[model samples]
Target: MAAYGRGAGVAGREDLPVLLVAVLLAAAACSIAQAQQQPVYTSIYDVISNRSDLSTMKRLVDGLGLANQLTSGTFTAFLPDNNAWAQAFTAAGVTEAQMLTTYRDPATTLVNFHLVSRFTTIVNGSIYNNALKISDLAVNSTRSYDTEAGRADSDYGLALTRAGNDTDGAGGVQVMGRSGPPALIAANQSDIAAGLSYCNVISAVARFWFDTYFDIITKSSVTASSASFAGLVAAGGQQQWLKDTTLTGTLFAPDNAAIAKVQADLKLNFSTALSQQDAADLVRYHMTDVPFNRSAPVNPVATKLKDATLTWNGGQFLSVAGTLGRPSNNVRWVGFPRSASVVPLLDAALLPLPSTAWKLVVAKSAAAGASASSGFSSFIKAMEAQMVVRYQMDDTSKVVTVYAPTDAAFARLESYTGKPFASLASAIKDQIVSMHVTQGAAYTPSGLLTATPLDTMAGSRTLNVTRASNSAAGVQLSGGQTPRGAAAIVASDNVMYGRSIVHTLDQVLIPAGVVLPQGGGGAAGVASAPSGWALLLLVALAVCVQRWALAAA
Candidate 1:
């Protein structure tokens, strides 16, 4: 009898509400597992095979050479088809160089801002909001997840539309936007309306797109000849040499203009004075070593040429400490031939560099050549002890906003005459970095909406808003009447589209002295960064639950 009772009790316990709870938990777990399945299409062809946008899809695919990668697995491509390319095509007057060199693209930003770590089905609304996801990363391409507000603003199906690459008829070209249309009419309209208002911004930030995070051969169409400073003159076995060098060996193969510059500068015959070895060093000076697409080493130590007289523009791009700026043209790597390559016979002339003696054999001695400061410098002195952002991989996806000041801006700092760099505190004593410290990427705009706030490394900024000659709110940056403030935003939203951002500011800002800009990093005083542990934990818990459930079953 005792045995029977015990057995009965155990059985009852197993069948009680506890059993119901376990079953429900199992179902919920399964749902989550399904959610994690992610979207997978073996190849782009697979998607095209079933979709009606055949011809359109093919053109874009060929342009990007995405098919090869698609064959391996599924990908959530930020598809910007011909139409997308075209819209920019008309507005595209913003030269690829400008786009690559300046401005920001919300869509492109999302593509890079978020990661493809695991397959993420980024339906539009999956990422959107005024609230930025990676707070540490001061990018405007933030994700706002508020469904109601987004839907109210017609945010729902937005992500879904992007996934579908939806389109509308307004645009003569086919593309998609938050509203879901095959036409780029919306983007265009926005560009048109906000364009002039933020033309500088778009041009600068979009340069991010042009900026390479990986090694690339920045090329454009050119006859097998010399035409510009950035033009190539490789031929025969030399062409092989061009192909042999790593991407870091930027071939400043002079365009006619650049070649002309070199001739004028050195009194040399472009045809004979410059040898292939000399060409190599010219290319070397044009390139500061990077892992292919890696962003310019941050606050890279002050560079000095051991040999030649080539100089880097000594100014921080219109960028903050934690961003990639656009003043990168000063350097280029040689190996890569296509990705960000821009080739053209300069309409004018080009220049050349000395190789054997100027490059490898000697330490870089050029005061102006490739010095980290010349790449981009926003303040009088950015870092008290210049530094470098250590990187292990090519990072063409990174972009920084550089706040470049003209030669005069620095000269205005009186103390620069000869006194040691001023400390970051005293307005007149020492304040090298304190001068160029605006937070967040300030896309250069010739000018923009009167209200747009300009963030500086200062973390918070004071905009002296203005409205033409009418409103008092107009900006007054760098000693000018800016619609924004003390920060004139000479060029607003200089979008560094793909991987880099470079903006040329008229004058540098002052960081109120030693007030390190927001999120300063390095051996410097910047504090430890925020942790990604929460994110890791979240992912782990999600994974563990599935494993446990599978094992139990």
Candidate 2:
């Protein structure tokens, strides 16, 4: 089949000859008399068969035994010339002598493609003046026609566009097909630009109906391995909306390797029943609302799925990174010839995290705390320097509850140390930071209020939790060193960073054996001396324990 057009509007072809003479005589009389005084015709078959240019279509209709049906119905047909027929014959590898015998049914289907079950007239000054007319792309005059491809619904159809002075100052008309740019409408041998009418039927010279572009679901089923699409289809991702051919769009299908990774990582086995919600959400993320062909404009395009969008990372070696390729409308379904959906064989399955979480960590974190002295910007910076937090960011399963120390808290830690936080050894700093996080569990502030002495990810150390009367002072977490005088929880229950739950603390909690000020008492100064041999041993122990714990994490 020839490539379907997508540019401007166009039409197609079929046959009738003995019917041509009568149509011409009627046309000649109308021209001689007033154009409005034309005789009322019996049906569309009369106009189509009488057109000398539509002889090939006439023969196809006759062979299909649909001549009588055409005469009795009200319909519109985009008839193509004999040139179009000759071209189709050449493409099918059949000569004109074998046209009736070799390509009978195929010719009939082609003719049926041109005949839409509605009466649409595109003449000057009519309701369709400079308007785009459309019809159901079917095999017959009604909804009951059936074929191997299934029944034709409103979702899968054809369109016609009329470009008047609005397009180019000079009026023009074009035909857009289902695939490539629409070709200019070829005039009939009679040189008539306007469509011919008989009774409730109208006929116009147009392009062929070559349904080459596959729908989104069909394209995915073909290009992607059974492992990927089969799971998707089972998950109900291939619903009627995806199967609609009338609306052109794109699909980002993952290959077998990607699907395998998802299965392994998510612990999903396609052998069992699919998780419909998860699979459907993932599939929706891969679909876009625009038809990004090679010629499509480069930009961030929105997807049908809410809050998800796609954009090209131009010049990015996506294949090297394991993605199919850069975002280009030019991408076709892998191993398929000219497909409808742009199937970029993704190296990995796309998993959409909660949008709110992504916005907090990646977007709002910086500006949100910029003006606050007791905000988490300093803790954010410190966490960025650690390799463990970075690893956790990429690991979807590791949920971490972080006790964020504000800028003022870091400054207080500096005052106690008599130096900047960075002046301390990296190992010591890592211990202090590790002491603030509770790994493998995300607790709400209410949960923490009743749970005291929680284990820290720094290996053996534990932190105390306390509940108070005032809302601001309701929940508190204290380091093992200082129980009564410790970091006051300023903000609580914030779970915006994926699996990471954040609770902003007003002060930095000191790890075990970290020295307190000279005037401090109680658990604040467990050691007899600051910088004594005992303090040295505790610091060394904290470092080793933290190193082991980080490795384990």
Candidate 3:
């Protein structure tokens, strides 16, 4: 019997392939029969009708007369379930009947906001579309998608962020409206297919609210803790301007902690210490006419106050003019209202420097542990060499934009000319230093970009300021005799004595028509001869060699 069983097992192994094929055929037939029995859905309406939890959404779709559109077109609907609708109704302090009756237009808009169509536009040969799916988005990334609620030219949209792992399913995605907390997509309820349409169940309704700059700084919960700025604005009597929704701009509001620190350091009470005009100027210094958002590129922006500007290089903080050493926190655009666009929180108040240009340069150079490249000792010396330049810098009454070269810049000049800056003739040195000094107006980086052909103390020459189109390269200043044709503004907007501002340059600005003596074995490539001592040593060695040869002979 054992021998017979072993032989039977051998026979079964040999016929395994035929048996597997037969079983696979039977399973496929069963799957086909099951698929044929199930009803096919052709629209999002059909899918919503089947799910009892989405009854409120289904009713809204029908009431809004969007059933035909959803039934025929390719769309992705982010619908709030019945529970979500109930929460929204309670939060809104209205019933479903009231929404459908009195707020019909808003109700229609709400439904449309959830619907994303396959509409596309070609701009600059790039195709932009509204169609999006869970598979189309990457994990831990945010993307803005246009919805059906916007007009033809304008885009009203929601920002969608996918968190966690891509395989984490519906729970990984979050939907953010313009002005409220973000809503999460329900787990296991996303990407539900209904023929050409798809449905995703969300936790809550995405909501948008209208708030002006004044409303945000004063009343918004996001800025409640930072009420110091609101106090300053009110104290300045600029409430009317901020409250005006028609005036669209970006406002950098310093937080309470920052305001407190500035008050302590400056020893001034914002409410009592400041005069009306001074307070107004202080308030305006923090604001700009340009509206910047998360989508906007980081660039040098001019503020309402002359010579006060804000700049960010996609870094962790913003660099405000006059505060070169201190950088404020990065701008947050999440909670700002539609009217303001961006109201970033600043960690420091925008104020003028306590000293004059000459004093700042002297202090910076003399300060221990100061960076060689950042120091202006060479610049200070150059100014001192020219009494007129020193006198001009010392004068607090005259508002001037001093383009001071760093120690590194002077070193570069020496390396190029093969001589120290001090070795140059007094008249030439004065011209070189004067070319850097732009008198009459204090210009920030933003101001410099607009104001080209700036007149300098060197009356014969004018400096041409040009910035790269991309703005990442920063601002450059060109004059008659620059080493690289242009000198880059390394550090900008150092507020100094009175209205005077100082910008540190990477290279020295030499005036036009002033010729610099070329250094031997320098950048000019002129070969230098051996020194007198070296020549004597070479001749002595040759004589010794010759004497040894004669003695040997």
Candidate 4:
């Protein structure tokens, strides 16, 4: 149970047993070296400081000279921001000063909970390594019930360890002595606890809970030293371009092991080759260009991704054990210390690519029509009247993704124009369409592409996205902006707009230059007949007839 729910973020797993620990460590070190020599980071420090969301966090990093060590640590931090700080204080029912004074030991303990000396953050989540430090883990073996003592009859020969937050004598994690409150662990214990279950693979978890964990082993860490996108391409110049995409998209990179499996399946090179699109798809699949959180799924519908419909209540073991009439529920378990004992494995499969979600259009429509008051056709008509101003629909209109402008937005527009919107012609209609109709479906930031160019009826507009930015307010299309000018999509995906999908903008965008030429074809005119041609033809015929008559006489 200790290892079951802790920091589990899966990139890819080989069907066979994982490689030996020594093999992995060497790989991790080598992989990190290559990344630094030719970095994936634009400015490593920017990402690092932004993680803390603190202006002072960068100052702290500088003071500690922690940049190099952190980059080298193979660890990830679940940094909290100013807002997170305020929320933590609010939840604790105490000011930051009061908490510092009232719970100094716990405060110290909480800080210790966050700092990790051995762990490093890498892309493909970890599966234990040889660096399983004896000092760090206080593993105590559980006695077997079986009476068999033969060499081949070792039942439960492996240790069944328990874990906790503080270290006991053997240096394993110290289990909480008793359950007073889940709060004592962190001053803002409730929020921290919820965020703890967020996945470990990428940077998205930062948006969900303001904290995240890194595994000791990760795909990025375990990579070969020579690995580089350019090098992979240069080796054969193999890194390929996305067919339609112009820039290098962020990826949910699979490690050598995962790619090796893919290669074996495809029967390609063991090394010196990569399916750039395939690699990109897998990595991007894990990404929510907008932040999509697996941990805080709001409902059963939300859980549809990855088929993780069941809530991970952190007590499955106890519930099962209680049902089975095993030992009392209050026993210490997971890691002999909490840090190493429990881990959570999160599936990135839930968030599919934009193209891939088109496959789920059926599911999306079915779910949309589940209310029983109206069928899909009625739903489509209603949505069309409201959201879309103009567009052609298939005869058996395909389930679509519509960028909905609320009735209120329309109401606002009518007030601005001082004219009724419904009676408008093409010229007038086109402007509204320009603002609403984006090319392709309204893929929330969680979709395949980001920084989508939203086409306005007037002209084209760029609608930026960040992953963590949910439409809690409205128009939730992308992930958390890494900073200003960095709009990424985050949160839930596969949202539908009637038959179509929809992500509304916060406020309807106002474009720069465009004029509406309404009712311009009403020019007055009179019809003219072809009298000149008729008169000329008649005269020519008479002349010919007279000549013929004279010749005959």
lDDT of each: 0.32, 0.52, 0.69, 0.31
Write the residue-wise lDDT of candidate 2 on 52-96 in tens digits: 767777777777777886776544445566776666556445665
By lDDT, the candidates rank as 3, 2, 1, 4
TM-score of every model? 0.26, 0.44, 0.40, 0.21
Alpha carbon RMSD to native, model 4? 29.9
Q: Give the TM-score of candidate 2.
A: 0.44
The per-candidate count of clashes, in order, stands at: 182, 26, 1, 91
- What is candidate 3's lDDT per residue for 130-212, written digit by digit as tens? 45676667877986666777531122466778876642244568876655567777877677677866778888887643345
Candidate 1 lDDT score relative to the true structure: 0.32
Query: Candidate 2 vs candidate 3: which has greater lDDT?
Result: 3
Worst 10 residues of 1 by lDDT: 195-204
- What C-alpha lDDT, on a 0 to 100 scale, does residue 73 get in candidate 4? 38
lDDT of 4 at 51: 43
Best by TM-score: 2
Error of 3 at 545 (Å): 99
The top-ranked prediction according to lDDT is 3
Which residue ranges in model 3 land beyond 4 Å of their true spot?
A: 14-18, 29-39, 119-130, 151-155, 166-170, 210-553
